[model samples]
Target: MAVVGGGIGGLAAALALSRAGHDVRVFEQARAVSEVGAGIQLAPNATRVLRDLGVLAEIERVAVRPEVFEFRRWDDGRLLSSTPLGAAIEQTYGAPYLHVHRADLVRVLAGAFPAERVAVGRRCVGAVRRPDGAEVRFADGSGTAADVVVGADGIHSAVRASLFGARAARFTGYVAYRGLVPAQRVAGLGLGRRSTVDLGPGAHLVHYFVAAGRLLNVVCVLEESSWTREAWTDPGDPAELRAAFTGWHPTVRGVVEALDHPLKWALFDREPLPEWGAGAVTLVGDACHPMLPYAAQGAGQAVEDAAALAACLTGASAADVPAALARYAELRLPRTTRVQGMSRDNGTRFHLPDGPDQLARDEVMAAAFGLSPDIDWLYGHPVPASSSGGREGARRG
Candidate 1:
């Protein structure tokens, strides 16, 4: 198997497949397979999958387990709702909720996978479905053929374009600014080990601890009328960010003040594809279903995709490769489509202007605080099991 793109999802796929006794290689475009300085939230749904992958111990070493997820009003700093997450979530879901720096997670995943199997600096230009199997063409005048090819490349996926033409991602009229600061700098604000979101009209702010409580990850998203550059490393103006959240709560203001260098990006997501792949090739993660960050399940769903793909292909013959890929898609599509919609809807709900509708929403949130059934379907669910029996695949040999 050949996996394209070495981001979190791609590496996770490669690791899972290799662990299942398949010879897998990863093609990464970057010279180094490291992520940027952002934080990722791993709900139980994600941690369960990670635990099964046998890397949860290493991940826990660098991850901070948040005690709770608290939502508050942006202006007055009133707690709207609180969801217990530390031990309570683990007891219910059989996994911990964690916050880890993106780069640290990538390092851990890459370390678990063999170094020689990952080919960096190899950019995938396109892919084709050959009679025997599939082939991935690279920009370096090279190619790799495999019994199955997985496209875990992100939103601008070249393999996806090669299979299903390029489509423009719909802009969500929102821009996000992210920054990381030492936790000590914000200690005066009394922020603890919790995932907090401050909701206001037309914008929201989220902050939590990462890197084992040494660093704080701050993200602010606001409605933008015009800007549409979808790059993640674009420079953002702290002054502009501060001005946008001028009347926000003091805690939010303090986080903004501690920002040293913030990166900004416009939020965009594609409509779910009718079908993820064709023949011996399939797509995973953002390549198949990109969603807004409002729900914080982007990475989690990708990890879930990795697990399901590996499960479906665990013991399939070369002739069964296409069927295995389809089974993976069938197991993942509905859930990812639902999550994509949930993330999109949360964008609207979080940015509602203070009025009757907002008041009603707040009332509901306040009443249903703590382990509400509303999210049980999301965080409480496990990866769908593959129905394939214990037949060894000829391709694995």
Candidate 2:
């Protein structure tokens, strides 16, 4: 198997496949496999898959287990809803809810695989499906063939373009300003202990502890006239960020004030694909189903895809590769489509202004404080038993 893209999703896919007794290699375009940015939430759905890959302990070492997710009003910092996580979520889902540096999680996943298995600066330019196997050509004019090819190269995937032709990603009319603040600089703000979101009209700010609670990861999203380029490393002006959320809660303001260098990116998502893969090649993560960040499951779903793909290919004959991939897609497509819909809907729900509908939303949130009713379906539900390791293909076929 050959996996493209060395980001979180790609690495996770590689880990799952290698652990399932497949000889897997990762082709990363960058000189080295890495992830930038501050924090990413590892909900139980993702953590459960991580545990199977044997990196839960290492992730836990650098991750902070937040006890709750505090949703509050942007203007006054009034609590709208408090959802208990940590032990409660773990007990229910059999995996812990954690916040870790995005880079840290990527490192742990990459480290799980042998160093020789990953190829750097090997950009995949095109692919050709041969009868014996599928082959991918790289920018260096070199090629590699595999029994299966996975396009986990993310939203702007080259393999996807070669396989499915060109498709534009919907430009979500929002820009996200993200940064990490040292815990010491933002001390006594009552922040860094729990994950918090300040929801307001047309804008919201989310903050949580990462790097073992020593750094606070902040992601502030807002609707603005200028749409940032769809790049994560786009630089952001703190002044503009401060002006946008000028009248927000003191806590939110404090976080903004502590920001040394903030970066921004235009948010983008794709409608679920009609087909994830065909023939001996398949897609995973953002390459297949890119969802908004509202649900915080984009990465989680990718991890899930990795597990499912590994499960289907385990102990399969060469003739069974295509069927195995199709089974992985069959089991994954419906769920990812549903999640994309939910995340899109939640994006609208999160930024509603103070009005009758907003009031009703507040009331409902207040009533359900300390418990996210949706967690049962989102976190506690079983994810196709990807851990069974390759038996699913035969059983389902």
Candidate 3:
């Protein structure tokens, strides 16, 4: 098996397939493998998949486990609702939610694969499928053929372009400004070291500790008429960011003002691909479904894709590869599409106009948190060692 793009999803797919007793090689475009972002939230669904792949111990070592998730008003520190995440989360979801630096999670996933199997600086240009197998072509005019090919490249995936014709990604007309502030520095600003999320009319801010309480990851999102760039490292003016959240709250302004260097990304999403596989090739992660970040399931769904792909491939014959690929799509598409829709819905809810609708949203949130049911249907899903050739089942723990 050949896995392209050595990001979290690619590395994870390589690790999962290798553990399933398949010979796997991971090709990364960068000179080295690393995550260049602030923090990533690993809901129980994602963490459970990581644990099954055997990287949970290392991940937990560097991660900060928030006791609960709080949603508050942006004008004043008024707690709208809180969901217990430590014991209640574990008991209900079968795993604890973790907030950790993206780099740390990448390291844990990368370490699981053998160093020799990972090839760096191999930018995948496209893929060519043959009767026997698929050949992954690289930018340097080199290629490698394998029985199976998995594209875990990000939103702009070369493999996707190779299989399905290139289509423009839908820009959500929103820009997110992200930065990492030291925990002590945040404390100095009078905002205690708590997982705080301040929501305003058209903008919101979420802050949490990462790197074992050493640093705080802050993300501020706002609806915008236009964005200048799509890259994650695009320089953002602090004044523009402050002006977006102007008159929201002092703490929110303080966090944005304290950012020495903040990065901005114009959020883009795509409808789920009609299919993720063709012959011996398949897609995973953002390559298959580029989702809005509102649900924070972008990485989680990718992790799930890796697990399901491995499960379907295990013990399959060469002739069964197509069926396995079909099974992978059937199992993944419904849930991921639902998540994508939910993320967009959350965005609409978060940016609700100040009126009775906003008050009704608050009431709904409070009631949902108070009557929180077991989320095992979403979090405790287990990848079967083999596809049952039946419709996938959604069951709670």
**Residue range 162-254, candidate 2, lDDT tens digits:** 888988787888888989988999897977468888889999899999999889999999996655454545789999999988888888899
Regions of candidate 2 where Cα sits further than 4 Å from its true position: 226-232, 370-373, 383-397
Off by over 4 Å in 3: 188-194, 228-232, 370-376, 386-397
- Backbone collisions counted per model: 0, 1, 0
Ranking by TM-score: 1, 2, 3
TM-score to true structure, per model:
0.97, 0.95, 0.93
| Candidate 1 lDDT | 0.89
Q: What is the C-alpha lDDT of each candidate?
A: 0.89, 0.85, 0.82
> lDDT score, residue 271, model 1?
89
Best by TM-score: 1
Give a tens-digit lDDT track for model 3, residues 113-231: 89899999999988878897788999999999988899998888999899988887877877788989877666766554356778788888888888877888988888888755645
TM-score of candidate 2 on Cα atoms, chains taken together:
0.95
lDDT-best of 1 and 2: 1
